[model samples]
Target: MWHLAKAPDLADMEVMAHEMFALLPEGFRKLCEGLIIRVDDFPTDEVLEELQAETEFDLLGLFQGVGLPFQSGEVSGQMPNMIWLYRRPILDYWAEHDETLGHIVRHVLVHEIGHHFGLSDDDMEAIEAQVTDEAAEMPLGAPARSG
Candidate 1:
């Protein structure tokens, strides 16, 4: 089992996020080099307002950034890719479902990042099969299970 460091005022969700990131294959990691992963207790008022979320826990994860395939040679400056993991909803999911925490984090992480790359479910599943110990044992990380 993977373990995260313990620190004061630290949200375990962040640790889970990091662990999930580490579990991704190196090939996938190389594809999302500048992607930012963040974890918060819940979506802020501003974020909620923008997403038009009906509740704080409505969203589990989000991807906000320019997809690489969309960029062209003329591109000079562009925004970075980012993935946000919602802690409250994640915790709620773990509590309500039969899945494990690690699995949940990986699922959310993969869905948000993998979807951005336009990867298909079959592709993700194939990759997951190649790295079963990392993907299957941890569970989640697929588009449908993301968050």
Candidate 2:
């Protein structure tokens, strides 16, 4: 089974992120109405420089744009808030740790979404716990798809 296993690619991670997002509490999901989620192999050079990351693997995921609490009225050309999941780094971390890929993806998703809500680490942890509990209750099968 190990020999047959392959690391998830960008599209796979994107689906995982969306599935994880769907697993989150309904109210929490509602708060993320206009949020966009994307996955890439790694952080871009500009992103690494701007975040002062020592390497592409240094950042697992990122939340870009102003958080809800900081938003004033809409600007003329403001970009929608986005969460970027660095696939390679996330895979690297998964290989080094004992956690499952789904767990790690859920974590990164929650953390970035937390930033969108201007939530603290503690708040995110609570949300993670809720998601974990809810997910465990769900029957094992295909992940929920977003339309």
What is the Å distance of residue 77 in model 2 from its true position? Answer: 1.0
Q: Model 1 residue 1 lDDT?
A: 29
Cα lDDT computed for each candidate against the true fold: 0.71, 0.83
After superposition, candidate 2 runs with Cα above 4 Å error: 133-141, 145-147
* Candidate 2 CA-lDDT value: 0.83
- The candidate scoring highest on lDDT is 2
TM-score of predicted structure 1: 0.74
- The most accurate candidate by TM-score is 2
Predicted candidate 1 versus true structure: per-residue lDDT over 1-147, tens digit per residue? 237633212255676576667667778878888788888778889989998999998889998887768756555677678899888787778779987667777778887877778988877766555444444344233332222
Candidate 1 Cα deviation (angstroms), residue 102: 0.4
Q: Give residue 117's lDDT in candidate 2 (0 to 100).
A: 77
Query: lDDT per residue, candidate 2, 3-27, as tens digits?
Result: 9878877887887788888887777
